[model samples]
Every structure is written in structure tokens, then in C-alpha cells.
Target: MEKFAMKKTLIALAALAATTAFAQSTATISGSINVGIMNTGASGAQTEVASLGGGANAININVAEDLGGGLRGGFDSQIRFNAANGDRNSAGAVNALFHTANTYLTGGFGTARIGSIVEAGTCAFDPWGCTGGAALQAGTGISALGGAASVKQAVQYTTPTVNGFSANYTSSLSARTNERQTLGVNYANGPLALTAINIKGSGNSTTDGGTAITDTATSQRAIGASYDFGVARLSFLNTVNKGVGGATTADFTSIGATVPMGAYTLLAGFNKNDRATANFDTKISVGVNYALSKRTTLGADLFRSEELAAIAPRTGTAGSGFVTRIRHTF
Candidate 1:
């Protein structure tokens, strides 16, 4: 009798625990992996073709608890790993190392997290899909100006939206150490959306051995917008960065459109990057994605970039590449 009662008690406790967990307002686990093969070709005598492997993987866990009185708090973390080489790289190092990648937090006025996190300027445009790609430094552009491969230590906050408008701000604590401050505002209504971000970095003055003083201070401003036209969506983005110390300034402008047909979507974009003074570089990409199922997609993209200049002669510079990928979500 005693043993049977003990077994029943344990079962009851397990059921209660499950009930408590389900009663919580929030908790979730999500992840995705994308793998693909790429063929690349460059101008001039450069190898015309080569096969390469590429992929991105990410896993995220989020938990939230209600604090009562219309206040709630939560924590979110993500681990991004490269399955190809079993390498983990980000703000933290091996496992989202840097302070901005894997963050822990608690809050009420909103929420605060410590670890690898994007600046407010980068996050403000999340809903409009401006938050990804090489242009956004989350992916895509190889030399994307914003985040790219750099990480920042920051504190950020987002204000509660009022009338379809929201704003955010992020500030860095350390000066001259990738320290950046940003402000952004977003508005969305019906089929139209707009986002604007401004970023400023404190110039670093320290250099190895002090042979020459280097100014690292720079500023960037960008605006992006998109409109849905039933069968297709049209988007435009423009960014300008002013370098310190008479260095060449850079500007990037992009325009693109996406059209949906049946189970496939076609996308095309043209971008121009003005390095120094004139239009020195330009890129064009076209992509098609076919949904094989609700959670699986097959896609291919072709991209080309060219350098136009007299001194460099644009030799050994122009390049073309194609990528075929399979992506699955779980």
C-alpha cells in the first residue's frame, strides 16, 4: 500500500507541474537551418567557377512571466552555429559569444537584456523585413556597412506603440570601443510601411604604438520603405555613411521588388554603392523560391557585382555567383 501510494503521489506531482507550466503566459523554442551549394565566378583571369558550401543555423528559446498589474517580463536567447564546420561565431565567440548575441534579462518598463543584442536602430525595422540581409549586416551583403561582423555592447529600449508608430533607442556604455548610439522610428498602416534609423559611432583614437593617430568616429543614416501592391511588393532603401579624417565616404541605395505566383516567389534587387565620390560599385541579384511544403523551401539566387573606376581598371573585380539552397524550419 505504501509503495502504491508513493507512485500515485509522484504522478500527481508531475501532472500539477505540467499544469503550472502551461498556465504561464509565455515560453517557446524555435530553430531553423538552411544549407546550400554555391557556384562562383570572378572577372578576368580569376577562376570562372567553383563549388562551395554555405549554411546558417539558429536556435532560440524564450520565456516570459507575468508580473501582474499589466506588467510582464521575459528573457530571450539564441544560439547560432555553423553546422558545416561545427563552428560558433557571433558577439560571444563560440556560442554567440559577444555581449550582444546571447542575452539574459528581466523587466517591466519594457525589458532589459545583457549580452549580444542589436542596436535599437537595427531592430526598429523588424516587422518590415528590413532587419535581414547583407545590407542590414544580419546577412547577404559581404561588406554590409551596418552590423556586418562587428558586435556592440549596448542597452536598448522600445517604446509602446501609439497609433501605428513606434520608436527605439540604444546606447553603448564604452567609448571608442565599437560604441554606438542609435535612434529609430517606424510606422505601418495597411499596405504601406516606413522605417528610419540614425547611427553614430564614437571615433577611436588608440592605435598600435602610436605611430599615427586614427579617427574611428563615423555616422550613418538610413531610411527604408515598402508598399504592397496585391501581387507584388516594392521596396527602397538608402544609406549614407560619413567617414572621419577625410577618408572616403560611402553611400548605398537599393531598390527591389518581389512577386508571388502560385507556390513560388521571385525577387530582384539592384543596389549601388558609391565609394569615395562616384558610383564605384554596383550589385544586382535575382532569386526564386519555391515552397515544397509548409516548412521546407527550395530556392536559387544569382548575384553579380562590378567595380567601375579608371585607376583600378575594374580588372579582376567583377564577379558573378549562384546559390541553390534548401531551408527547413522546426
Candidate 2:
């Protein structure tokens, strides 16, 4: 009788342990789909079906596990696609099964991330959430890892927030001769948020036949701030790019505002790029969105640009355009 009781107790303890382990780990899948129609001022193709408002049609898979002792580990993977043609999103810019696959660990020591991690502060000030026709001109687009939004074989570390302030650093594991590095600091409290970042591109130099071969590198610095005033939220971003000799290559300034009125919200923005060659590119965008439910929205936008850079070669020149879209998340 004593032996049987001990055996039963052991089995009960084992079952409890298994249940606790399962509860401590989780895997979830979620994503959004955006589809819309667009008409632009481009010469030949002026009207088309595409994801409106620069929103993503993507699927996200996340897996996380508690490591105990104030530590946790996780992996996040995202796959983005074009809703119109069913092609991979940004195929020209990146060709891969997953747009991004990041592995990270978080704890009181802050967070450390690796793999094809997204660049920090890429489009924080973009009211369009950094994806589509509503994106700001590329001249001021901030990317810490080269010109793309994400870089492979990179690592990042962020310090724990203290008094609404924290710092972060990221660098690619590419060859040291031609590497990319980014450093940033952030502050957020109540209705105010601020960020500053510097991205540097390292050039290569070598001695060949007693001649000093040099490649000029460039660096970009940007500052962004936003404040929420209940009825309206306002944002501003300023960016400066410099060449090897500290010569200003370009300067970009943008201002944006969003107003909420119940289920309908209005957005507006203006951007200007000043090139060193005495040339300027400017753009203006205005849009509104109506929330049909917690997971669905309807939106429309009208925008015009003078020499606006192409968001993608396949999308062609945005120029002046209008778009209407339906977005749903699950």
C-alpha cells in the first residue's frame, strides 16, 4: 500500500510539471492584409490595384519561451506578399522565404537581437507605418542597415529604459573594411516621444603599388519627435547626410499631423529634400481612415510629389496619385 501511494504521488508531480512547461511557452500566428486601387500621374500606367496607404500584406509567426530568472527567448518571422499579383513583397529588394527572421532574448539587462533584424528607427515618423504609397520621399528615409529596411547577419543591443530614456546600437557582421553601424537614443513619456540616431557607412582603403586607394564613406544623422494632444498628434523629423569631408550631401525635413474624430481619423504631411546641387524635391500627402471594427478599416488618400523617388521599381513612379483601400487584420 505504501509503495502504491508513493508511485501515485510521483505521477501526479510529473503531470503538473508538464502542464507548467506547456503554459510557459507559446506560439502565435498573426498578420494583416491590405488591398486597394491606385491612380497616379505616371505617363503610361496611371491606374492599378495594389495595397493602399503603403500598408503591408504580411503574416507573422512568433515563438517565445520563458527561460526563468527574468529572462525570455523568442524568434519572430514575417512573410510579406503582394495582394494584387501574389508575388513576394519587395522581391527586387530582397528575395527570401521570410522577409525577416529575428532571434532575440530579453531580460532586465535589456534585449539582444540577431539574424536578419529590422533596422532601428527606419520610418518611425511615417504616418503610413513605413510601407506603401504614403511613405515619405526616399531622400529622408532613415535606414540604419544600408538602404534596405533589414540587414542580414547583424546584431543589436538595447539598454533597459530608465526614466523614459534608453540607448541602442546595431552593426552588421559584414567585412570590417566596408561595414555599417548605427547608434541611437530614445525617450518616451506620456504623450511625448523623441529619438535621435546616426548611421555610418565605413569605406575601404588599401595600399596597392604604394598608392593609397581610398573609398569615400557617408554618414546620416536624424532627429525625430512626436507629441499627442488628445484631439491631434503632431510629428517632426529632420535628417542630414554628409560625405567623407563633412560636406553636406542632402538635408530632409518633414512635418506630419493626425487628428482623431471618433472612428474617422485624418492625416496630413509635408516633406522637402534639399540636395547639395541646389535642387529640391517636395511632396505632400493627405489621407483619412475610418475604422469599421477593431480589426478592419477603410481608407483613402491623395498625394502629389515633385520628383518623388520610386518606392519600388515594379510600382514605378508615384508622382501624384490617389488610393482607396480596405485593410483587415487577423
Candidate 3:
């Protein structure tokens, strides 16, 4: 009888341990669906949908394990699709089902993440939140150097906040000689936030035979700031891109403000890009958003642009456009 009771107790303890281990891990699915009707001088009126903060449909899978000693391991994957046609991507290199897949570890040492990850600090100063047709970062070509939205095969590290200041670094693991490196520093306290970012890489300038040339280094530097004062929030950003031999290729500046009134928020912004050879681009945007619920929003925006010197590609000509969108998060 003693032996039988001892064996049963051991089995019960093992069962409890297994249950505890399972309880320490968690998995969740969450994301958003955003769709809109857009009209532009370049691409007329059309139904469109895309991803987070960019009018796309996406599903996110997140899993986390509580590793003891105040450490945790996590995985995040985002699957973006076109709500209009159920396509992986309308047009881009990110045609795969999973455009964003990252593994991260967090503890007292801050956070370290690797894999194909979403680019950080892309929409810090855009009042439109980088959404729809009037998105400054997307349309005005402010973040053209790094392609604005995504980074692949990269490693990222972020430091813990110390006195409302933190630093982040990310580098691509591409085999190319001009692998990109990005460094950013951010600070936030009370209603004011500030950020500075630098991206450095060698241009893929090659000879006629496609031999890689590393003689010239190109870089982009940006500074952004925002302040919230109860009813209104205002933001500003300045970015400069330097080409080979350190010649300034593009200089972009933007300023925007948002005012909230109960469930309605109003936005307005203007931006300009001054490029080399007298080529320049400018835009003015205004919009409003209404909160249908905590998780749903309806918004509309109107924007006008002048693409002098054809700095960036526009639809037909520099003109005006509008977008109406509905978005829901879960």
C-alpha cells in the first residue's frame, strides 16, 4: 500500500507540472481590416485595400512563452491580403503570405528581434497615420530611401527606456556589399515626443558588367517631433537623403496637426520634397475621422499634389484626389 500511494503521488505531481508549463505559454490572433474608395489624378476612383495603417487587410498571430527569470520569448507573424481581390499584395516584392515574421526575446536586457520585420519609425510625423491615399510618408516620398514600410532579413535591438529615452538599431543581413544599417533614438515625456533616425548604406552602383562598387556611401537622416496639448496634437519631420560622394539628393519637410472633438478628429498637413536638378514635389492634405466605435473608424481625406520635375511617379499628372475609408480592428 505504501508503494502504491507513493507512485500515485508522483504521477499527480507530474501532471500538475505539465499543466503549469502549458499555462505559461499563450497564443493569440489579432489584426485589422481596412478598405477604402480612392480617387486620384493618376489612378482615378477605385476600390482599394491593403495592411495596418496602410488600408490593407491583415491577420496577426502572436505567441509568447514565459521563460522564467523575468525573460520571455515571443513570435509574431503578419499576413497581409487585399480585401478587394484576396491577393497577397497588389504589387510589390512582398507577395508571400507572411511578409512579416519575427522572433523576439525580451527581459532586463531590452528586446532583440530578428527575421523579416516591419520597418520602425516610418510614420512618426504623419497625421494621416500613413494610411490611404493622402499618407505623407507613402505618397510624398519622404521615406523613399528605405522603401518606407518593410525590411527583410534583418536584426533589430532596442534598449530599455531610461529617463524617457531609448535607442534602437537595425541592420539587414543581405549578402550585398551595401547592407543597410539604421539607428534611431527616441524620447518621450508628458505630451512631447522626439526622434532622430539615420540610415547608412552603400549604393548598389555597379559598373557595366554588374560588378559591385563600394566607393560611394549613401545615407538618410531624419528628425521628427510631436506634442499633444489636450485638444490638439502637432507634428513635424525633416528628412534628408544623400547620394554618392555625400551629395544631398532629396530634402523633405512636413508639418501636420490633428484636433479632436468628441468622436470626430480633424487632420491637416503640408509637405514638400526638394530634390536634385530643380526637381521638387509638394502636397497638402486635409481629412477627418469619425469613431463609429472603439474598434471601428470611418474617415475621409482630400489631397493635392504638384510633382514638378517628376521627382516621383504620380498617376497622370499632379492634381487632386480624395479617399474614403472604413477600418476595424480586432
Per-residue CA lDDT of model 3 for 1-330, tens digit only, reads 999999999999999997688558799999778777766644343444433343246788999998877788999888766665666642224256675789999999999999876645647678876664677765422232223434567899999999999988887787756776778899999999998888787433312211122424688888889999989999988888789678898898888899999999999988877772332367788999999999999998888876522424533245667778888889
RMSD of each: 7.2, 7.0, 5.3
The candidate that achieves the highest TM-score relative to the unseen native structure: 3
Query: Order the candidates by TM-score, highest first — what do you get?
Result: 3, 2, 1
User: lDDT values of the candidates?
Assistant: 0.56, 0.69, 0.71
The number of the candidate with the highest lDDT is 3
lDDT of 3: 0.71
lDDT by residue for model 1 over 67-118, one digit each (tens)?
5455556666655555445455333322333223434333435555554455
lDDT of 2 at 316: 32
lDDT score, candidate 1, position 154: 55
User: 300 in model 2: Cα distance from truth in Å?
Assistant: 0.9
